[model samples]
Target: MKKIYYIILLNLLTVTFSCSKEDDLEPTDIRYDYFTVSPDANDEESILRRKFYEDHNIHLLFNDTLRHEQRGTYADGTPHWFTELLDLSYDITSTKNETRFTYIRDHQKQKEGIRYAETYILPHLDKELRPYSIFLVETLEEYGWRWNTVAYYNGKRCLALAIQGIAELEEEEIKERCIDIFYNIVDSKTNYYDEELNDFIALGNKLHGETFESAGLSDDPTDEEIYAFGFLTWSTWYQEFPSESSDFTSFLKAVFYQKEEDFKVQYASYPLILQKYDIMKEVVKQKGYIF
Candidate 1:
């Protein structure tokens, strides 16, 4: 009877220990499922996106439904969810504080933009130079005043190009848009031939007294000052002297787009411009680009 009592007690203790151990055990991992939609694999737009991804390792996110998470409740008891796309632009002049949202809704324009990129833009850029993701949207505007084609949000590139009359755009217009896209990518990534770029800036400083303002140029400089400073385009010139990076991009555009003979003829008197152009041509040639 004593042995039986001891055995039973030991068994009870063991069972209690096991139960306690099980109860104390906690989950090491926790996961929450997000309800979001992705582009259909078989759809036309998705097919183009997949092809672009496979070819260039670039994600063209046109139709992927961004997950909307509940943030907080509004004064009217409505749930204020976190928006996937945030308005990066700000209006200092306005008294109102509001957030705006924009998205890509047109399937046709999305397809057209992707096709344009694959055909006109991707060929010029090396695989490493391409952005990880490109978001196609209808319009990216700030305070209903200024509109933009390209805007960077959360490290991703946003293209607001699907306007009302997209289908009516001429071939040349489309190609120009593609070139703008190409320019943006190249400008952001590549450091222009450093020595040549420095030389160009030095030339500008020599003529413009170290800075645009120091040379007596106003906030909005005239065309004469812009040309004299060796800026090939007005867009590249800013209030102060343009950054070295921007000067490189401008030089690149001049060499890449315009014919050498035409550029030489146009800037015949400007020896500095001619020298910079030569440097850009050599740099582009080294990168395996013909034009």
Candidate 2:
């Protein structure tokens, strides 16, 4: 009787294993489509984008709408998901933490943006310092404030440029915007050497308790006053001190845009300023940038 019971248990185990093996061999009806279609070979815009990708290692998205995903938790701790269509707008409200929806519909402006980048922006920037992708859009407003010509986003370094009125802008205005955007990109992307940054911060600290307002300096400082106070620009002086990373970026912008000789002469009276300038200059140079 015991042997018969054991035989029955073995048969049951064999049947279970056979059923599991059969289930494993069954095919499922699920599919995943993750690959992006390549641009048309004969398209002029596509050719230009491909060239940028090949030459500068940048993905120039002139005619594409990017999908931005944002995830967070609701007030009651439930998960919330958001999908935003990235485009340009002039009157985006700050009430919601998202921009108003739009699309890149101006082909002329898009082409102009690409040409402007090729002519003035891309040539000046080092390949390593360039953002992975540049999105040309109609207008770019962050949180309903800071109407910027260019803004950098995320570790992948996606850059967005507002090119709504590219054709309408004067030549000088276009050049200024290009340079401004270039410096802004460099300021945000370049990683400074720690020792150099700390030294620069130390120099800034030495000027503690002294501000342009207290020193009787002009709110809009002349070149001479800017050097004397060891601040490279009125904006940097306005910061009062460089206590954070963003403040350091301000210093970098001031230095990058100023002529080297003028910077040296202006900050001559302040040893700390000169020291900070030298440190900043060296660090930037090491990153294959000239300012």
Candidate 3:
């Protein structure tokens, strides 16, 4: 039966995980000579993978190849750190998926918490290596885990352990980003509300200017800061686009809060902004920013 197989697989995973945990060893080789073809480094997938490699020195292989260059792969043929995270293969109940898939669906919660904590805990973790830096917290939130306060209450020990792993990394800027994400999650109204949601919206609009100012890169920022800005603007473009997440990324990129970065440089041959603005307006409404 599927249930029986699920149970058996979980038990095997437990034993394997225990052994892997005890080992606590880094990969023997950390270089990748193979090249998978990929588009320009500007591609989101390419950029994300490159940043991951630069920070952790861990190689990531893409599902497909682009040009002649290798997309990404480890020098040695071994499992990637991320792959290990997804490999737990724990089961979710058929009933749960029919409804909202809350982060803590079952015992798998304890398992993931333990794994993340043990691998990322300190002195291996850095003080600045909070969740936001690596993009995990936001990535999870976009899917609606509401992990902000829940993670702390449900898995404090594991949370501490994960932060520890961050402390050990060399990516200081990434670490800061992670910390910011942590605050943002905790600050989200759906997770935990310190005040009316609109207050946060007002705060976002008030500091909108910082979005352009922080863009240390040589360009002017619009109301939409980064893609996150777009996401945030989408969250509250007409209501509560905040100064931190959306506006901050725009400031970093030196663009208006409403600016769309997707096809800014290639507008000569085809029209992109007009279509993007239309999409943004729709997203803003759906997110309750316009209503």
Candidate 4:
């Protein structure tokens, strides 16, 4: 009887430990690693050729340095992917009714809207035999996240540039990870005090909430969209508020729980977005944006 009792207790403990492990993992954010490399990336056509080649060869080839340089800057003197063209002539309603320009020279007007493709946008196209840059296309196709530049002969110039080299050097895991990272960024909070641009990160989310009487959520959102919604809303709230609130955990609950009604009403109370953004920025400066 003594031995049986000991065995029974051990079995109970094992089950408890197993349950605890599962519970602990329930809340952990999913992580992923993105690797860069692909066969198509090495193909001759995949190179980002310049208009003029100073090298021995008469023709130019893709230059990675230029690509990085272009990607780093903002269109209208900001450092963000989307460069909104604010129209001062029009009222607030007309502010959003302006043409978007790709800061990168490539996507600029072609022959005054009639000519050969611009040089800047080429390096961003996928040379894959089949349909390429589906992810980018999907992102653009979405209602809230439209490309901010003019559509070139191929497609949105900046998006093409974004996918160019990155496309052919295909790593499914990396692509997925990149998308995941983007979603995480959109869903995470921003801090208004840290920088002005970061504050705008939450614009989409605010508009979303303002548009819908209830929080706007479709039944089935992709992993990327789910992450984006959370990150963007968090960013907007965080940027607006600076102090920490006790409702932090509860706010997260409302967000993930699809409690749009609860979230829209309660997110104002939680100030963790900016606080967390600050900590994240300090801990990983170049990595993820904090607050």
Candidate maximizing TM-score: 2
Residues 1-291, candidate 1: write the lDDT tens digits: 999999999999999988888755677876532211244547776676677677777666663344567988999999998755422332344443232335556676777766666666567766555555655555543343554334332233333333334457787886665665555555544574455355555666554324556767776887666777676654434456555666776788886577789989988877768877886677655454434
- Clashing pairs counted in every model: 0, 1, 46, 19
Which digits, one per residue and each the tens of the lDDT, describe model 3 over residues 53-152? 4554433323212223334557786443322232111234322111111232223433443344334332233333323212122112111344232222
Question: Over the stretch 186-225, how does candidate 2's per-residue lDDT look in tens digits?
Answer: 6655644466576766655455444566667656556666
Name the weakest run of 10 consecutive residues (lDDT summed) in model 4.
Answer: 129-138
Better of 1 and 3 by TM-score: 1
* Steric clash count of candidate 4: 19
Worst 10 residues of 2 by lDDT: 88-97
152-245 in candidate 4: lDDT tens per residue?
Answer: 1121111121232332444554334343333233233333333533432343244322322224544443434433333433223332211122
Those runs of model 2 whose alpha carbons end farther than 4 Å from true positions after fitting are 1-44, 63-97, 100-108, 145-157, 190-196, 202-250, 288-291
Clashes of 2: 1
lDDT of 3 at 142: 15
Off by over 4 Å in 1: 1-48, 63-65, 68-109, 140-164, 190-196, 199-253, 256-259, 283-290
Q: What's the lDDT for candidate 3?
A: 0.35
Models ranked on lDDT:
2, 1, 3, 4
Model 4 segments more than 4 A misplaced: 1-4, 9-37, 49-291
